[model samples]
Target: MTTPNVSTPRLKAPAEVASLELNPHDLSATLYNNDLAPTTRKGRTWSSYSIFTLWANDVHSLGNYAFAIGLFALGLGGWQILLALGFGAILLFALLNFSGFMGEKTGVPFPVMSRIAFGIRGAQIPALIRGAVAVAWFGIQTYLASVVLVVMVLAVAPGAAAINSNNFLGLSTLGWICFVSLWAIQLVIVSYGMEMIRKYEAFAGPVILFTMGALALWMFIQAGGSIAWSTGEAKTGADMWLSILGGGALWVSIYATFVLNFCDFTRNAISKKSVVRGNFFGIPLNMLLFGVIVVMMTGAQFKIDGTIITSPSDVVESIPNVFLLLAASTALLVLTIAVNLMANFVAPIYALTNLFPKHLNFRRAGIISGTIGLLILPWNLYNSPAVITYFLGGLGAILGPLFGIIMADYWIMRRAKVNIPDLYRTSPTGTYFFTRGVNFRAVIALAVSAVAALVLAFSPAFAHLSSFAWFIGSGLGAVIYLAIAKHGQEYKDVSGEEIAVAPTH
Candidate 1:
């Protein structure tokens, strides 16, 4: 809650100013929290390696493993699933670059970045939307990680099953214990701040990759070096193509939240090249490799046990070796904790902080996010495949338009130029303080595009096109925003040099 009055004369260069160097002192108290301020050059310490490991940790999560293997259960062939993963990874890379570039260039978080398109107060639309999604995912991931803990608990003490059998509020007593334990662990870890999180990601990412490789190899050997290819109910011709496209869309939808708030991480990146390199290696290549291993492990398990276990945690449970079980359980904990904090936890903290900058800093906002995550009863959301599918589809529909609108405004209309001080200004003369601090054009575009996308995702007639909700929503949002904004004063182009010399007003 402390607002320092330090002079920031060096903030003349938007590209060079970091969080501490930015002139938040001259801006409105409501809009200029240190947590939401631009990261200083000194603050941009994340290297390409940091980004690579970050993505590695992101890919190695229990949720992602279950997500990838679930494609096989959804009638996708192993090869088809691999294709879907690759397609999603490539598309994700491109979209991440779009968001990451803005973060790197301007050193701003996602909610603040949205200000360029959504206006000052109007930016809260996307910010709150993203915060809600992040909270849900946070709860879901905590539940997923707790599943791993439950496995470890049962392994150590069989009597825990009796406790697990007794249910309340859609979760068992044992399940609640495990969930709260993992939640507390994550809460403790993230409380140390982003520097500690970054270091942990760098270490955990490689360990996870190695552990997965070993597990896959072990599973392959256990199945006598043969792969099970005919495990799914395969589709042919047009059905097959639709499955591939839809499956890829589903994969992309899983990371839709990450794609939007990628700036939260990229703002810490040392350079744009670092972000690109990290994403290139971490996303497409890492995903393809991880997918192949997932296929190997699951396909081998099918061959060995005559049935496939979709949940990676369940797969670990079946291992008779106590040592291997403990090791795998530890890996799963590390993997989930890394991803939950980096992906689910950080975004919401920033979003909530943006909502009331003067009252909330990172740590306080993080506690609120975690509390909300627990209150949502996330276990119910992850109970069935149908629920999961519709939930993600609906989420993508809402988030897609926001992405398109922000990217369109920044890359298309603004030409990558942003006025640094203007972003924090709340005065009538401020460029972003339009129409009483709200941009109705962006708001209208979001409402129209999200509603149409939601209809496509949920309506019975358009159910077949449900998977393309994100694409359709984003495309429509961009088109609609551009059409309406072209005739307005919102599209004014401001250069970097102009931002450097622009008055705070």
Candidate 2:
């Protein structure tokens, strides 16, 4: 990574330097520098492999495989499904590039990036929303992962089946025990902070990938070298294309939510190149390869069972070798938990901290978020299709527009320049201190775009548009914010000169 320019004035308050006409060339480096503790300088440490491994873990999970196969089976032929997967992956790649650029340029986390659009105090709005969503997902992913464990244990010890007979709120006693155990394990991993999390992802990523490959190869061989892609049901060209497009769009949007927040991790990267390279390999390549493997496995399973099988657990259970099934299932459970902890768990910890930096440190904030997830367990939100659709769709809608507004404000309005110190200030002189630390323009844009997206999600008349909600929300949010900012009144210029503050020890 390029070094931040040390010649720039050291400001006590970031707002004091907001008006300075900084060279656009230094913008990326400045953003990157901002992500680290002020005590740590650039190039002193790097995390390229750690970041790359995080993606490996994220992509190689059972949930991802299930989701991929489900998309393919969305009434589309194999070729059409492949097209959709490629299209979705490409869109995701582009989105990640945009968001990741901000992190590379400014070494700040996602919540910190929100300050540019939402204002310092107002940033809490997005932070809280994002963090809450992450927490819910964290719980769901953990629960799903634990299911594999339950299945594996019951296979080995038949007595454990009784654990599932007694139920509470739709979940069996064994389910509850597994959920709590998984939750506790995640909490323990997160308590050690990002470094430990990074290490775990790195170690678990390769193992999961190798195991998945082995399972796929074994399944294909068991099918006697005649693995047909045909599902036996034929469809017209138009119908097939539509299915592919719709399925692709949904899958893309599902993953795209995190692209906006990718800087939360990439800001710790060793170089902008590393971030870009990792994303290229991780998003498109990994997703495409994974999709193909999943489809192949699905086809093989269909031929064997004479019915569709979406879950990896079901596929494993069908395997003749009990030992192989147990080993693969165990690996999958570990893989799922690793990804869940890293992607869904750590995100909210940092975001929640950004909400109340003075009061909530990282560890406490993580616990708080995790606890909220646990509280929602009684609702059984994870199991309901309607609930899952609304929850994921609603959050996905907001994420797109919020990302658009932030990117537009930073790259277009501010020209990639940020008064780092002012980002945390509460004074009127602060650049982000617009109307009581709130940017009405951004709020209005968010509201408008979010409304549009929600309408598509819930209203049957607009149902077709639901597939592309992310693009619509983000584009409209950007346009709306830009238009408002163009006419909005300006305040005092606090740009160039540095304000005095003690260096962080």
Candidate 3:
């Protein structure tokens, strides 16, 4: 009996083992986890640089340039435009820093982090809303990127102009060809996944910076040295300040939607320090430099053409040398496509999958979302100014409240302690489970703020306050949620793995 003595192996519970098993149905959730984990401490520094490159790609694009100059076209002078750009960029910087901090502290993506505020299941509401908006923008940006491809084709084979003669739904045959081709190109790039995107940005960021600088210099030379303000009529200082504030607020609001979700990418950072530093270099410095270049180029083009040119393509076309014009156009095309891919394409792919973790995996969800975006193309729904304004404004309204609620809940209410494991569990005992998977305080805060923002958006009486909708909504939501949740009830005790919130410095 003594000789037959044996040792027993420890048996692990099936439920414990099951948690570690990879579920193909939840590929998006898996990717989200992979994206959030800091695999190496050294890689943390790259996060900031990656985010900085992201903003560089975002700010230096043709559309952003056009938007900057469009402010001047609103009867504001060059100085006023500069003021607006400065103010708007600063506001965006601040908001992005706050949002990025959450990612850095928790090592979680935006949709997952949102579960803390909106609840585990309720997070789907914001995810779907964001995904829908992203899909629409993705289609529009793809269309814009195709413009360059079409131009290159026409330049090489002049016969291609004949394709433009036959039209369907306001688009020529050549335009449709370019659009589909570019769309397919983006799809292929996205399919390669996020690592490819990082490499693409590393190259695209510097290339765009160089080409834009060269184009600005060429424009200045063509204008014969100096350029003056192109304001058609002079205005009082008071009027100029008013215009600047209005324009700046509008720009900030337009940017606010994306800025709130900055964590989506930054969560991959290996360290929080890198993210803050990267945002510092990226937002204010990069944007200010890009804004200056845009203003200078627009001024130079104004002097030469005797009419203000808002679009970067218009500036490219103004160059007398055909070769230089072609070069600039090609660069703008590359820059546009890079930004469109980063900002629009990747976000929705992940977001949509988050909505149906048990049904659509990442690739399948991306396909579904992409297909829906294509279906929306024939209507040209994205082109309508009224619709675009409403879409952006409505998103801003919801996002503002969401941001506020998350900040208040994390920093003010919980004192920044998040139970990481509980985020994945649907048990009533989870930290995020509030009233059967919905936080009523957050819901009410969002609803109230949204109604106020919508009123500001649609009612002429509140038109004067419309530009500040983002700020108003966020501020109100944070205050209201804090007031409600502060005295109401404390969250239930969950698993005791306490993660410290990074201190606000």
Q: Candidate 2, residues 187-236: lDDT per residue as tens digits?
A: 88877766667678888878887887777787788787556575667456
RMSD of each: 7.8, 8.5, 5.8
TM-score of each: 0.88, 0.86, 0.87
Using lDDT as the measure, which candidate wins? 1
Clashing pairs in 3: 44-270
lDDT (Cα) of model 3: 0.71
lDDT on C-alpha atoms for all candidate structures: 0.82, 0.72, 0.71
- lDDT at 372 for candidate 1? 91
Question: Candidate 1 — which residues are off by over 4 angstroms?
Answer: 1-25, 159-173, 380-393, 487-505
> Which lDDT value does model 1 have at 248?
84
Those runs of model 3 whose alpha carbons end farther than 4 Å from true positions after fitting are 1-45, 168-170, 359-361, 391-393, 486-505
Worst 10-residue lDDT window for candidate 2 reads: 496-505
Candidate 3 lDDT tens digits, 1-505: 3687678998869875675574322222522343322223233334667877887788887778878888767777677677788888888877777777776666566677777888877777666667777788888877777777787788778999999888787689999999888777766666666666776787788888888888778888888997767547745578777778887787777665576666666656657777777777877888778877877788887787777776778767666776777777777877887887777766677676666555654456666766776777823765687667687557756777777788888777876767665676666776677788778878888888778777777789987787777788878889988888745446542332132222110
* Candidate closer to the true structure by lDDT (higher is better), 1 or 3: 1
